[model samples]
Each structure stands twice: as C-alpha cells, then as structure tokens.
Target: MFSFRNFNIADWFSLYRIMAVPLLVAFIWFGERQLFTWFLLISYSTDAIDGYLARKLKITSARGSQLDSIGDQITLVMGLIGLWFFENEFVLANYQLILLAFLPYVLQMIIAFRKYGKATAFHTYLAKSSAVLQGVFILWLLFFGPVYWLFYFMVIVGVLETIEEITLIFMYKEWVEDVKGIYWALKDKRRLKKKSVKNPTS
Candidate 1:
C-alpha cells in the first residue's frame, strides 16, 4: 500500500514528511530551535500542498489517504514534541488542558484501528479546521509564543472533532475517506442498507 514506486506526486509529498522525521529530530537534538521551527513550518505546508494536489489532480486513493493521514499524525506529533522541547514552560503549565484535547484524539485512533486495522482518513471539514488551527498554534508558539485564546480554541475544536470522528467510525463499517461530516454521513449510501430486490423498500 505504501510502495514508493507507484506513488503519485501527492503521495510523494506525504512520503516526504515521513522521510524528514530523522532530520527534524536531529535538529532538536542539536538544540537548533530556529532550524527546527522553520523545517516544521515547511512540513505543515507540505500537508496543505499534498492535499490540494490530490484533490485537484484526482489522484486520491485509499493508499494515498492512509499515507496522508500517517504523515499528518507524524508531523503533528513532531510539532508537539518540538513544543515540549523548546517551550517546556508553556507545556508544563498547560499539560492538563493539552491532555483534555489529546486523550480523546488518542481514543478515536484506537477505535479506528480496532475496527479497520488502521487509522481513518475521513478528512472531514472539522478535521481540516482542527488541523489548521493546530498547525497554526504550534507554529505560532514556536515562532513567537503561546496565545491563550488560540490554545483554548484549538482544544475545543480538537474535542469536537474527536466526537465527530467516533460517530463516523460507527456509521461506516468499512474504512472510508474524505467524509465531510456527520450530516453527509447520514445520507451516505455507504452507511445505508442494501434494499430487498423483490420488495424494493426504501
């Protein structure tokens, strides 16, 4: 599923994030804060670019979705670790609030993995919003400092996005991608039952 030989340009972008992990960690180990933040920003930017290119070029696929989701998680985890390393004071102060958002995100991943043997790639609108806010918050904190309002907002959206993800996980028996939200899921034929051929019931 992750074969580089068959990967499209968008998939290659996702692969780039995965490939950059060691370099990113090396920056941290070397105490290169400026370099790490700039590189992290580039990682986040690749996320947006890959997603856009996938949609625009119609190269979206199950493999691509899975790769993209993995890349996003890896990048986000790296961002948070960068936050902890460079901004230890802020993390120490807000560990409770951060977990309030993070724990449920972990739970959602657990639910998806248990059911599908992998993480979801719903890529819902709420998920996109949360990702953007999270990327912005992490970058802003690393570049300047934490903003209280943004932190609170990111937490709220993160929790809400988790709830929506859990619901969607239940709604679809099979792994799926690019779900917009619960509303669309309700009308999704994928979630509906097959009609009786003879009865033809609605």
Candidate 2:
C-alpha cells in the first residue's frame, strides 16, 4: 500500500497526512498546542486538495481511494488525540456524547473488515460532509473552544454517515469504492450486475 513507485501527485498529497502523524505527535509531546493545530490544519487541507486533484487529473483508482481512506482515518484519530490532550476538560464533559457518536463508526469498521478484509473507501457524499463537519468541529474546539451547535451537528452527521456506510456494506455484497449514497447505489450497474450474475435463474 505504501509503494512509492505507483504513487502519483494526488496519492502523495493523500500520503502527507500519514507522514505528518509523527510530527503532530511530537508537537503534542512538547506541549505545543499552537504549532500542533497549525500543522493539523495543513494536514486537513491536503485531504481536500488530494481528492480534487485526483478527480481533476483523472488519476482516480482503487489503490488511490484506499490510500486516501487510510490517511483520513489516521488524521482523524490523531485529531481526536490532540483534542483529548489539549482540551481534556471539554472531552471529559462530553465523553458520553462522543462515545455515542463513535460507537456506530466502530461497528461500521468492524463490518467492513469482516466483509472486505479492509476498510470501505466508498467516499459517499454524506461521508464527505461528515468528514468536513468533524474536521471543522475539532479545529474549532482546538483553536477556540467547542460550540454546542457545531458539535451537535457534527455528531448528527457523523452518525448518519456511519449508518449509511453500514447500509451500503449489506447492499454491496462485495467490496466497492466510491459509492455516492443509497440513491446512487440503487442505480449502480456494477452492484446490480453482480446480483444478476449470482442468481441467474431469477
């Protein structure tokens, strides 16, 4: 997955987040909240840049999607760690809410791994929205503090995205990437053809 020979410009951009992880951890270790937040912002920016570049350049591929998803997951985990370290009181105060929002995501991961032997990189529109809200909410908390409305919206969108992902898992039967959402899934010829192939008698 980390093969440099096959990586393109956008893949390298996606890889930036994973490569930044150790530096981010070091920033936290030295108690450099400002530096950590700044670098974290840069990391998040790469997420948008990579995706746009991939589509614009027509360099999208299964490998690229998987790599991007890996980078996103790493960045999110590190962001939450940074939040817990810098905003311990806030995290503790909202621990239950955070856990509630995270539980379904955990379940989705488990389901994906069991079905596909890896994580889903569906990149649905809802997933994109959820990622944006999560990054915004975390950055807001880190830079200033939590806004109740933002946090609530983030949690709601996140849970909905996870539910959609779980639903897609069952719908696909086999692992697929870049599904937009259920509406698009219903019209997905790839999925429909797979079903037809499996039950030809029907």
- Highest TM-score: give the candidate number: 2
User: How close to the true structure is residue 107 of candidate 2, measured as C-alpha lDDT?
Assistant: 97
Candidate 1 backbone overlaps, count: 0
Please, what are the lDDT tens digits per residue for candidate 2 over residues 1-202? 4689989999999989999999999999999999999999999999999999999999999888998999898989999999989999999999999998888898999999999999999999999999999999999889998999999999999999999999999888788889999999999986757867887985
lDDT of 1 by residue, 102-192 (tens): 9999999999999999999999999999999999999999999989999999999999999999999987777888899999988877444
lDDT of 1: 0.91
TM-score of 1: 0.94
Candidate 1 residue spans exceeding 4 A from truth: 194-202
lDDT of all the models against the reference?
Answer: 0.91, 0.93
Colliding residue pairs in candidate 1: none
Q: Which candidate leads the pack in lDDT? A: 2
